[model samples]
Target: MHTAAAVADFHTYPLISALTHLERLPDQLRVQWADGRVSPFHYQWLRDNCPCPQCVYNVTREQVLEIVDVDEDLVALDAHIEQGLLCVRWHGGHTSRFDPGWLRAHAYDDESRAERLAAKPKSQLWDRAFEWPVFDYAALMEDPAALLQWLLALRDSGLTHVRGVPTEPGSLALIAKRISFIRESNFGVLFNVQSKADADSNAYTAFNLPLHSDLPTRELQPGLQFLHCLVNDADGGESIFVDGFAIANALRDEDPEAFRALCEIAVEFRNKDRHSDYRRLAPIIALDALGEVAEIRMANFLRGPFETSVAQMPLLYRAYRRFIAMTRDERFRLVKRLNPGELWCFDNRRTLHARNAFDPASGARHFQGCYIDRDELLSRILVLQR
Candidate 1:
């Protein structure tokens, strides 16, 4: 039983003072905070989340007590506030202690959950006129602070330009290793972006590649892409970029039905060759749990035939065409000529990339490319901040 003396001593425990009341019910416990917010926790949940050394390993941080070992109908026989912690003695002779701060931090009430979800960082949408964020490659490679700022710019704007990189082979891989290990695919660790005699994909040709995301056929697409221009003395191989998220949001605002269809219908993406065959079925626009656009997968060259029902085929095509048109719109597309010694990096999941047709006989246009997962870039940013 809780006593008045224990409650009076809460002033020393600032966390305990936040709790206005605690009600021990038959199967669960309800805590009313000083702010008038009520949070409920089941007995089993509290037991599972117990921070005591007996229940959790102190060094490994792993849970020692299995949920099956606890009684399914266990109840708190007695509960009290002791030294800023909520102490509970269970019916089976097991005791648990919970810090009020932990409880408040891990609150799962409707209001708390909503607030947490709303606090997530949102990407800043951009159009063709948006100025590209540029950083010195030498400074970024030498200084940790410059590297973090460049990475954050990529995270927020979905694109960044790094100039003054040494124009040489394998430079892209070295730059990529600064953030994390390169994400290797069938193309190899460091792929060449030059015209080939018999190209496996359109990206290897000198033809004007349509604006699209890379490797959509794979189940797990690469998150970040690095393209280092070693030689771009060509006539007309200008680079093009479009923000897929911006176009996706525009579709959602202008034609909600089209947006819904794109999000609901799953299309097939396939990459088949003599040596390898990869395939995946995914929606063009993937929404997160909060119904916000999380990723955009669009690759016309790799997109296979629609496998949806005949009735839905027309709707899917309409939405697909609308999205493709939006990507090509001059207002959304940014065209720039990447010069030698310049490195371009962008979010592969958010930015659609393309190239203009160049005359192979005009001059040489060579680039080294590599990929890194999105999580790696984000992790580096967090560690740098610390």
Candidate 2:
């Protein structure tokens, strides 16, 4: 039988191993599991996570008790294992019960923590030779498994294609909604990609666009980008994609100094027009807590003049030029001409995209684009997984 604490959380943590014994200490409780794993839970942590209806709201299943409300020196007067649960009575009249399943799942033991870290999904880097991951739009729209697979490809590989899409002007919205809500920017919810006489950005004109991430001028760049081809009757304008992570990793292996320079120096990215002017200063590459390459921000057109110390100017320029040259390298580029009724969805931050100049006079070309944050994609994936 599951305790009230186990049923309170959104996730159902299965009993992986049963609790064998519990020992109470001055400040924490030591637990021993059937799997021979020892975990220590501090008295404060247990009290703060109490899932009783009095401590946590029953409807939302959210914790209502704040740790500050309880005494900082709060000690458990007694703690014992009863009915496969860890029950703790506080020095005061308060009490907290932890389910065996939940406790094991959240165990902070070194071995358990390492196991969890190892099981996390990691990016599968790829280059020009990557077998393009393509999915049928109809399947993704109707089947949960197919949708999950497509999202996983975008998450791991950073690039994906969807075929058999309707060529309607606004059909991109339908497929975008399959993931989650669209992220709105200064360019609007759904932006059109076509040549215009009065253009605000280089993307609005028929020009050879350099490989770059979209909207680096913003504080938080969009995670996923959807560009759906409605009409591709024009000549040229073939899409070019390069795995930014792959290029970054190659730089790290080949020239550690350049990689370090890019990661350390902050540059300015600006987007200005008659109506709006946005700018942001950040390093070209960002690392996560574990010192792994987590993001890449590159937009040659949107970049302002490089501003750095006179001593480091040469190194910064050398690193910047090297990174741009790598993007142009044939070994890293994957060039493809998207046809009507097809859409390209990719990780905007990790996949640098470009376009060859097309002749607008030859014929007409039109595409619709939108953005979605990473949180939405991960949240949808988790819900679909459940």
Candidate 3:
């Protein structure tokens, strides 16, 4: 009953396993769970993570104690389990108590680590045959559960479509706010997609834009891209999309060398106009700490010349071309014509998008686009899930 778990963080980690035993080691505390799993927490880690009023702020639930403030050779004077908690008396007369639920949740033993990693959500790879996750904009706007479903689809599938959105200008912001604030860039908060005589980028022109992620030139590309169709009477201009992660994985299987080349080699992507210039150097395919595909940074129109050793230059080109070719492959592409009152929202980092050339003389075509970072999406998802 006496626990500091609620004061530590926003999560409510119910006790999955009771704290059965605790052993005091020289520099760490070893805890055993009722389920027979063992976890070793370093004394410093426990002290630094202390949830008490003195060690952590009550209002923000953020840690205030610095590990360096304690002696490097600090040890636990005594350790025991009492009242469903792991209590420790420090050698310097300080004390710390950990809730069993929180303690088990933060356990770092090999088995526990593996269990947590295995429990993490995985990306659901999709191909052209995949049916899109469609949602009703009105339902999402009015219902919390509907919003959570849409967010989950965006997180796992990386692509989604919403219908019944208002076709008015700037209406994209209303749906975007359901997640968080729009990420601003040189292109303004909401950019109009239409032909312009003084176009700063290819997206602004009527040319057939190749498949690519948005704003790869920035250090951190926008995570989610929303394009709400307001008018589509023009001929051509069908939207095309490809799962960059799926293609990257296929390349990893069919042509590992090319996949490695894209993952290891860094290249420059640049965007410049009379008003501003933005540039970034990063690998086309990014892997997480576990070596899984994490992101894809690619925009052919914005790419600068390849800069690498002469020997690797050829390899880079081969890899880059192969990646582009894969995006073009019909097996992986999804082509759809968005109508007025419909919208496409997807992970900008993992879903490469493009448009077919349209004749300005044919008719009118207009769309409003905006961006929201991945952090905001995940945050909103967690809060809604809670």
Best candidate, TM-score:
3
Each prediction's whole-model lDDT (CA): 0.86, 0.92, 0.92
- Candidate 3 lDDT trough over 10 residues, lowest sum: 1-10
- Residue-level lDDT of model 1, residues 1-386, one tens digit each, is 24322221212223433666789998889988887889888888988887677787666656788989988888889887776578889876888877676677567888767866777667999998999999998898899999999999999889999999898899887778889999999999999999998899898999999988899998878999999999988799899999999999999999999999999999989988889999999998999887888888988989898989999999999999999989989999999999999988999999999999999899999999999999999999888875
Model 2 regions lying over 4 Å from their true place:
1-7
At residue 26, give the lDDT of candidate 3.
80
TM-scores, one per candidate: 0.88, 0.96, 0.97
Regions of model 1 farther than 4 Å from truth = 1-21, 34-36
lDDT of 3 by residue, 127-236 (tens): 99989899999999999999999999999999999999998898999999999999988889999999999999999889999999999999899999999999999899
Give the better candidate number (1 or 2) by TM-score.
2
Model 1's alpha-carbon lDDT is 0.86
Clashes of 2: 0
Q: Rank the candidates by TM-score, best first.
A: 3, 2, 1
Off by over 4 Å in 3: 1-7
RMSD of candidate 3 to true structure, Å: 1.3
Clashing pairs in 2: none
